[model samples]
Target chain A: MRAAYRPGPDAGVTVSDDGMSVYVARLPGGPLLVLDGAAALIWAEATTAPATGWVARVAELVGQPEDAITADVRAFVADLSARELLVPLGGDADPPTRA
Target chain B: MATQEATGAPSAGATVPLEVRIGFAHASVQWIADRCGADLLHVKGAALDPTLVPGRGYSDADVLARPAHVRRLLDELPRHGWELINTFVYGSSFEHSATLRHQDFGLLDLHRIYPGTGPTPERAFDTLWSQRTTKVLGGIDCPVPSHDAQAVVLLLHAARGGSDAKAANDVEWLWTSADDAARDRVLDWVGRLDAGLAFSVITGTLDEHRDDPAYDLWRVAARGGTRMEEWRARVRAARGLRAKLTVASRSVLVNVEHLTIVRGRPVSRAEIVAEFFGRPARGLREQVSRLARRSRR
Candidate 1:
């Protein structure tokens, strides 16, 4: 299984004024993805800490139940991976499930 | 950390960061202008308000000065090591502005009037100067156009350049960042400049109009001329046999300096001549077809 997920090499991230995470690609006139507060926290943590426990950590930080957010987190990660905003570690695998 | 190169020398292959070079250029130009008692208004590029669009990259610095002060600055700039590269005179107010080069600074475009094709350059300059705001750049007080004025200039520039991406981005930034009052002010300036057509196209306001006479005027404006005005310009451009020949020759030969800048290197005269004649022809056929279609209407 993959150890973690990380932002793509071309992804340039900046924090918006309202605490959203804005991700821009290296290419000129590329798409801009603005991640909301909850997703921003997840991305902030995922970029630094291991992705293994990010689900529980994000759930705790957002004051949501781990089960309540499990599907949404997985979906968000999958969508990001599909868009090359997030890349899985150790090649490819299913989106990480809550540890 | 980059030391300024010898005054008036060419950078050639220097590795100085662009932003650092721009800062140096702004400071150097400001210092020299102050010494000559010339007021300099920094426009475009790094002069953009960072709070609206941060981390924007700029290749050159553009500054506007009074027409009378331009000659004095031009004569004195070389003494301080700024090399005068070119002076292109398109018309009275439609000049190319001066292109200056320095070893420490990358490229500087000094204008006596705003370069965009819009309302009269003198009027634009007076309005912008009246509303100019001072911003400190590289420890030098630089005058910048107000947001409303900047928006109008950027829109006109984008329209003239066939809607370039960077120009569009800057205009969009200004549009989104402006408050209702600022937006209204920009619209008023656009109308005054006869750039309402360009503005409508840029902001997609044209889409809401249906067979409107105003829309027709905007379309004509977007093309940079109406049919009668274009014909008059052609007549003016070909006033005499020598002028006609000059225009004809220019159509086939690229200016060596222009070729050099476009190619990003020193180009030989022969290369320029070859590129001029060998360059792909423009869409003259398509243009004629469009003209014919318009005539039929």
Candidate 2:
């Protein structure tokens, strides 16, 4: 299934003063995902916006061509989804929308 | 100073982080303890080096006092704005009986024992007290356990808490900060606690990486036997049938204090029950699948 991505419902994120974003899973002893640079930007955007145009947005931010960045963004998002740091939007496991 | 004057009026201004407030509370508690002539030794979160856990936060100040002087602390601490909240009877190492709460300072867990339970030597508290030295932590001159003693307690705590990341980090800091002599001393104490095998296993793994090993030998050693050893110890520790029943009931019941501590609010009885049993089913499925995969290997 082609799944859209969003931040995991249980993810608690904290961005440090040094621009490192720490995404801790709400589950006890869950993985701590530390993102920096492009990865951090992708995570910030993914949490707030849909993942449909993530590649182009990230490419623009990182000064890379969309074609060059697409594969890396997909890989990163896939890894995060596998780790439960990113969840499939509009699925059975989809989180309730925030107000 | 009156209690209100000491704690000051509850301010609605910019709030300080809990960790920073805890630092000030440590100093305030020390000042009160010294005034009461009760020798105090800081332990656990409050005693950990800030350099090691940069953003580490604490919900309470853990202080160890001589068993003889506990009464004095109970009397004097209240005068300084620490109100007795509730007593806990869990078999925790480093905690005595009760907890105290202050408006500004948060919680204070008063202890009469060094390492609360497990396989610690009978005179562990006395030994730790004798070796206690003054260290300036967050500008508070407080007595802290000797490096060797602190290492033992930290390792045991980590093991008991199921080798959580924070605990592992604390142990790593202890290892890297200690000199060869201090390390040897810690190993000696681990030996006395009959935890040398566990200690070696944990340290060996930690040296290789920061990952908490799936199987922790330290936990086994802390129980003084295998996985079943802790239950047997608890049974033995219980004074009477009623005491044993109390322990058993506590294990089954949802501890509201635990919920409150974790959530930072007073959770209702129903919420506590829900929290206790609301283990994500996905986690269980994942664990089973992991075990199945391992077994297939």
Candidate 3:
């Protein structure tokens, strides 16, 4: 699954070693934070799925209530998107820092 | 590989040093304050830190403002010739400047709110913000915050960032500079605000890493050195465990005080280092020897 990681300047998306989880940091603050294990798994799927209905897909895999999982996934993307961390796959946003 | 030699843990027996990086920092900040036309407050422990490290306290400078002025300062960064770094999420909010380097004087820090910012039981702003309590530096008049205020902030900075040897000196200066009444006021304020949290952290460091060479460095007076690997480990571990908690816990606090009361004898750097690493470096060889269970992850 795709997730954005800013190791230095540019943001790149890649599947995590664990394969299930993804890590993302937004701007306004360069390094927001880190989360591991299951949460990372969900995050990776949401950021990378390349479909409008990825939220529903994520719910099925994580084995949680569908509506709750969908809402949470949406909220996570909204935050990263608001912080300008992620773009809508093909489109871009504000000036990316040096990267 | 971590040792007292690398971390530059201040020796406990050396009385105090005469110069500190904080001195230049203070000077540079003062330069900024005068330029901004903001009222400057006397930062108590910075002067005393020099006594311990010979040149450490020179790096500190502080000023107080009504909460509203901070917004104006942020908006005017470009005009003032400073770049706005991230607004700090802990203690009181402050900004960082990438440009204010003084020639060998020290880095300057301009503060808006004192960490844990509040007047203590024995002090009010009037007493500390007095006209007479200032040291004339580049020729501008400034008021000093009470010693108690300075001490408390120092402790929080050490706990917040954990590498400020400067803050540790401020803890020691509670005894060196202020009277017993002021010290009690600081301790009382600390207890009132977050005794459980502070005690948990301070004692946690003390219990786990007190015997490492880093701890030993502060126990004896010796010239200090940088322990980059050890420092990095502490930063990584502290961030791993406390990173999320740091922003959330400090969300509601008023201005951050950057100093604290210097109580009795100072805790050793080895202790601070050990606490940061979650174990004493000195005993790692032995601890590694006792791999009773080869549990694989």
Candidate 4:
């Protein structure tokens, strides 16, 4: 089964000066960046209105295919986790219950 | 008119041996700079947005040692100070610690470039070096990276320290401060790293600045995975908790706290310490226990 991307509690963020700071944080140790500004568009779409499968919906936001959003979401979450920014959701192991 | 200066002064020259950086940990840098006398003529790091002032802001302390004195300065000063901390891979030579109580009081980073570079890649440093300007620092000739390089370098450094460091929040100012051309030039520089795992990490960072009308660099960072628009909400949330942050100890139970006033409300320092470890304040209990122990002693 394909891993369905689930959005966590981490807030959507946007850098004003753009994505020059792609993966790395603002200065020393911070969050990851796509540098393509994908985080910006998704941040807007997902912020005010909460949704399920928010990651896969990114493509729709950027005028790309839904598959593209899913792919990018996987990559973004993977990168964020590697940098210690996002905590793992522990898929399949734990059943999802509405918080 | 003739005048006489006060005789009591801080010691000159480095107080400890120089240590090399394994990756980006700065604690080693601070430990050594303390013992070594840091004249602190000029400290550079992060960006110099037209609105941003040099020599101000919540800055990470950096110190410069004369090239001629570099070898000798790093060689001596081990006995005077005890070990404060060391990184995962501390270069045998570079040892960081805090020694002085003025200016760079809390954590001092010893470096050839004090608080130098924005959080930029090595290539960014090369770009900075390419356009370096020679300046006399502490009575010696020194070449400093251009403001553009400085800005990028500061951002990269902030990225390395994670969300815990104060200077990292300077990204909030970058969009609100720098011009489009300057911001675009930086995005172009970072665009070079778009096709790797590193690019994916740029998402959260890019989202932080998605709304700037000034430049589209966030678009560049979005290519990795996350788009700038996706981060708008997080940016708003981050702005709420940005300033008041701290990583108090290096122990396994790392203490994180927010220390600044956000939106006119101050972040309670004690609450922050507790929040850092997911528990309520135990400081008062600990304080009482310590007092009891002292009474018995």
When candidate 1 is compared with the true two-chain complex, its DockQ is 0.01
Expressed as tens digits, the lDDT of each residue in B1-297 for candidate 3 is 000111123341121122222333343344445556644554544533233334443433444443444455444433433443324442222221122223222233445544333343123233335422565332223455444545554554444334456555644554346577866786675665433333233334433545332232221112222333333323332334475355334332222122111222345656444444543343354345434333432
Model 2, runs deviating above 4 Å: A1-99, B1-17, B49-59, B84-86, B90-98, B116-122, B137-140, B175-182, B191-233, B236-246, B249-297
Candidate 1 regions with alpha-carbon error over 4 angstroms: A1-99, B1-16, B89-95, B115-119, B176-179, B191-253, B263-269, B272-276, B279-297
Better of 1 and 2 by lDDT: 1
Cα lDDT of model 1 by residue, A24-85, tens digit = 23211123344556777766655544546667777898898877887787777777777676
Mind giving the per-residue lDDT tens digits that candidate 4 earns over B87-162?
2112111122222212112233344431212233243234445665543321123344455545554554344333
Off by over 4 Å in 3: A1-99, B1-37, B40-55, B58-65, B89-106, B117-132, B161-183, B188-297
What lDDT tens digits, residue by residue, belong to model 1 across residues B1-297? Answer: 111222323442232346545655666677778778987788777676776445667898888886668888888788766776666542211344778887656578898866442455566667678888987554357788886676677665555444456756766666766688878887888766656555666676764653543344344434454333433333343447786565445444455666666687899878966775554333344456678988999
Per-candidate DockQ vs. reference? 0.01, 0.01, 0.01, 0.01
CA lDDT, candidate 3, residue B183: 61
Q: What stretches of model 4 exceed 4 Å from their correct place?
A: A1-99, B1-55, B58-73, B76-108, B111-127, B136-140, B160-169, B191-297
lDDT of 4 at B49: 32
Please tell me which predicted candidate would have the highest TM-score against the true structure: 1
Model 1 docking grade:
incorrect
* Tens digit per residue, CA lDDT, model 4, A1-99: 223233333312223344321122211211223233565454333322234455445566667766545544555556545544344434421113322
Query: Model 2, clash count?
Result: 2
> What lDDT does candidate 1 reach at residue B50?
72
What TM-score fits each model? Answer: 0.54, 0.50, 0.34, 0.31
